[model samples]
Target: MAARIEIEGDRCIGAAQCVLSADKLFDQDEDGFVVVLNGEPDGEDLEDARTAAMICPSQSITVVED
Candidate 1:
């Protein structure tokens, strides 16, 4: 199965680390909160997702895999 990225909007502080780490997989909304560009990411994008989750200060991003 593919990896799925999940963001807890309430936990996001609009740091945008996700965007900086993985622009292809994540983006910021008008309010500066996290907006998922691709919920399911693969290949290099999946690696970026993991990086984003690790770098997120607020720990709002989660990558679930099976």
Candidate 2:
């Protein structure tokens, strides 16, 4: 199973920390806000996704086990 990823738009402060940490699972929108490229992260990506969540300056990233 993969992990469910979520990003709170309002909480995002245009920081690309998540992107830097997990480019495979995250990206930035036109506005520079963080976006979840993959809602369900694979086993290997799951760790990166979780790291992205912690690396997020605005704490906008969320990973839920599905």
Candidate 3:
């Protein structure tokens, strides 16, 4: 399955947990909020991306199967 990661800017609180959990997939913006560096991460990185999304405190990260 192909996975896509999306971040809800409105819900993000600059916790940086997503980036901390999965740096390859997530990056911190000037405001410290998370941004999806590579929306589509592959192989083992994909699992980490999903884990980051699932662990987000703000529930701002979303992972979709395509």
The candidate maximizing TM-score is: 1
Number of the candidate with higher lDDT, 1 or 2: 1
Give the number of the best model, judged by lDDT.
1
RMSD of each: 0.7, 1.1, 0.8
Model 3 — TM-score against the truth?
Answer: 0.92
TM-score, one value per model: 0.96, 0.90, 0.92
Model 2 TM-score, 2 decimals: 0.90
Clashing pairs in 2: none
Q: lDDT tens string, model 3, 8-62?
A: 8999998888888888888888888787889988898898988898889999999
By TM-score, the better pick of 1 and 3 is 1
The 0-to-1 C-alpha lDDT of every candidate, in the order given, reads 0.94, 0.85, 0.87
User: Residue-wise lDDT of candidate 2 within 1-66, one digit each (tens)?
Assistant: 656988788999987998888898888888888878888887889999889888888888898886
TM-score of 1: 0.96
Candidate 1 local lDDT, 4-64, one digit each (tens): 9988899999999999999999889899999998999999999999999999999999999
